[model samples]
Every structure is written in C-alpha cells, then in structure tokens.
Target chain A: MQISTEELPGGVTRVRLDGRMDIAGAQSVDLKMNIVAGSAHRLLIDLEKVEFLGSMGLRSIVIPARAVHSRGGKVVLFAPTPMVESVLKTSGIDALLPVHHSLDAAIAALE
Target chain B: MLGLLAASMPEALSAWPDPRLTLTSQLEDLALVLPWLQALADRYALTASTRFAIQLCLEEALSNIVRHGYRGRANQSITVECAPSPAGELVFTIEDHAPPFDPLAPSAADAAPTPQSIDELQPGGQGIRLMRRFSSRIAWEPTPSGNRLTLAFPLAR
Candidate 1:
C-alpha cells in the first residue's frame, strides 16, 4: 500500500492509495494517515489503484475518517472498486463516510 | 513480489529476510501477514490450487494459532515459515508455545467449524476440513515444548 498526498484547490488534500489495500497496507498507510486527524480539516481518500481490499482494509478507513470527523471535518472516499464498495456497504461504512463515484465528485463533496 | 524480489531480497519464502515476517503469534499480525503472503504467492504466479487452498488454509491455521495456540497471550510470539520444494510444493511451518494439544487428534466437537444451527448443516469445522482440502498432506508433530503443524500445497500454475 502507498499513500501520496496531493493538494487540490479549496483546501482539499487527496490521500491516494496505489496498491492492494490489504492488511500490511492498512496498518502502514492507515495508521500514518490517521495522525493527520488534528492537522487537516478536509480530506479525500482515493482508492482507484487498490487491487483488492479485505475486511482489515475496510476497518482502516474508519480511523482517519473518524478522527477528522470528530473535528467536524469530512472524509470522502473516491472511486472505490465494486468489491471494495461492497465491503463498505455491507459494513455500513459507506454511509458512515461520504463516498463519491469520481475524483471530481469527491472534490465537489469536499467543497 | 516480482518487482520486490531480487538477489538482495531473496525470493525464497523460507529465506525471506525481514524479521517481522517471521513472527505471527497474534491474529493482528496474521491480518498484517496474509496480504503479503497472497501478494507474494500471486507475484510468484502460484496456481489456483495453491492460491485458494493456501489462502484459506493459512487463514484457518492462523486463526487456530491465535485462538488456541497462543491462547491470546497477546505478549506471546509465534513463528511462521514458508518455503517451496523444487516440484513447486509449498510447505508452511507454524510453531507456537501453546499447550501441547494436537488439532488432528480427534478434533473435539466444540473445535469443529463454526456450526450454523441445531438442525441445518453449518459451514463449520472448516479449519480441519479446509486444511485437508487444500493440502495434499497435513501433519501434527507433537513436542514437549509445543505443537508443530506442517501444511503443504502444490504451487499454482
């Protein structure tokens, strides 16, 4: 799993994941990003390149998103695959966070 | 992984270099380790027989290791070793210091799969059955110290 941050207009920071968002990726990437809870107000997580994400991967999103949410900040997950999106829906996480079908949608959500 | 492995990295699973790769007594760690296993197996182009069985068996084995082997000590550590034979048979070795009970010696009814109901057949005892289904061979070697399980599967095409 990899995370690279891209700054968009309107104070939106996009955290992109570019690999299998599995267990190893979850801990290494999710834990590190969750620390941004205090620092950032608006965040978008891009999971387009993630090949397969397991239940652990599903759990990883809750952390940073919730951390930011506590501060009244919002997290939008962008372009999750069908399977990953299914996991989110089954676990009720899709509703917990804002899910966008496209990067533009995510940016729009953040705006 | 194909890109990650090199002479420096050692593509062989047994000869794997990282220390973190060796310890897996914790379920949390298994959650960390399985993805790498799946990825490495995929990168190696492991066969479907190897992939599905090994993945399921490994998950079951690791779950057993966490629930029964380590007894959830939380502080305890377990060793997991994965190596392949020349014929592409994959051998996985897991050893833990839990009680010397053998999972194969007449698995207790309670030790069976997660049974679904009182009448209806459940998807239970999948652990033992899955181990049998996936691997051509499953052995439980007892030691004064702990239990050692060796599971072997054919490398995927």
Candidate 2:
C-alpha cells in the first residue's frame, strides 16, 4: 500500500491511500496513518485507488480516525470502491468515519 | 515418446480441479492470498462482489487463526480449500492446527453494547462481524487436531 498526502485549503490534509487494505497493506500504513492523524486536525482519507478492505484494514482506519477524533479533529473517507464501501458499511465504520463520494463533499465534510 | 507421455499424465488433469492454498501462521503469508483468489475468480467467473466477499471472509478467518488461535506463532500450518457445493454455493474451508476455538460463538465482544462514538469504538473486533455479515453461510467445527471454519457464498446473486 502507498499513502501520499496533499495539503488542501482550510487546513485539511488529503491523505490518499492506494492498493489493497488487507492485513499486509494495513500493517504497511499503520504508523504513517497515526503520524498523519496526530498532526492533522482535519483529515480526508482518499480511498479511490484502494481495491480491497478487510477487518485489519478497518482497524487501520478506525484507530487513526479515533486519534483525530480524540484530538477534536475530523476525519472523512473519500470515494471508496463499491466493494471497499460495502466493507465499511458492513463493519459500521462508515458511521464513525463518514464516507463521501465526491471530492467537494469530502473536503466539505472536513470543513 | 509423445504418445507414452500423454498416456502417463493423470486423467484428473483433463478436468477442472478444486483449488487449495496453504500457508504458515505468519501474517506475511497473507500476501499470497489475493493473487490465488484472483486466479480462482477468473477460473470460476465469480462476480466482483462475490470475489470481494470471499477475500474479506478468508482474510478475517485466517488472520484470526494466526493472531488469536495460534497466538502469532510462526510455522504453524493453515490450509484453505475452495470447492463448489451442489447447493449452488462456493464453500471455502479454512483449517488450522491451533487449539480449538469457535469464532462464531457469541462472546463478550458480541454482547457488548455498540459504541456510540469513535471514543467508544474498538478497532480489533470487527473481523468476526464482517465474516458474519458477508458470508452466505458460516460454520465452525472442532477438528480432532484443531479447528475448521467453513464459509459459503452463493455462486449466483
């Protein structure tokens, strides 16, 4: 998995995640995600390129989202693929970390 | 020589065979799983959603075996076999040599009240829930040596 970040207007950081978010993928990004969450007040996790999501992947997202949330920050997931979205919904992580289908809507959520 | 070689080949090679994958208890072995599933999906013409469900459930099951059942021990044997059922489902059997544990059984985690906020959320327990929600049917049995989990998905749907 690859994680890249962009600084958007209004102090939001767009962290784009690419590749499968399976066990290995989750492990590969866990530390970086925590670091990003620790610093950014508003986080937008772009999942457009993520092809798969499993339970461990859910952990990778939830833990960071929680870190941001505890710090009074906001996190929004952006444009997960259909299958990945289903995993999010099924696991109910979508409730904790809101999912937005559009770039505008996603950035808006962080704001 | 060519005719003799052809006759010597196993007759089963002419037919489509069930697929099987084996791995050690190490989490890194998971890297091998998706590509194997992709091959199965191509061979069986599985729908994208079906393939995704299988991958999700298998990862959940296997990871649980490695982490909790085997306690992250390395070199333990784990095997996964995929076969088509007569009932119009594709069944995946995951067998492990760890001590018996029934993941499907209702546990404290299942009974715990749902978290109302991110503060209350627990990151690690979602695996069993995902397996339950995504699989068409799930069963767990204690094998003589360890445990076996069977997850089935409808071939059509």
- The lDDT values for all models are 0.67, 0.88
Q: Write the per-residue lDDT of candidate 2 for residues B45-151, one digit (tens) a residue.
A: 89989998999999989988989999988999999999999999999999998998888777823842456788887787788888888899999999999999999
Model 2 ranges off by over 4 Å: B1-18, B108-113
Candidate number with greatest lDDT = 2
Clashes of 1: 6
Model 1 chain A poorest 10 in a row by lDDT: A86-95
A-chain TM-score per prediction? 0.90, 0.97
The 10-residue segment of model 2 chain B with minimum total lDDT is B9-18
Kindly list the per-residue Cα lDDT of model 1 for residues B25-99, writing each as its tens digit.
666676666666766686667864456556656666776777777777786767777777787777888777788
Span of 10 residues, lowest total lDDT, candidate 1 chain B: B115-124
What is the i-RMS of every prediction?
11.4, 1.2
Provide the lDDT at B116 for model 1: 33
Q: After superposition, how far is residue B55 of candidate 1 from its true place, in Å?
A: 5.4
Could you give the TM-score of chain B for each candidate, in order?
Answer: 0.73, 0.86
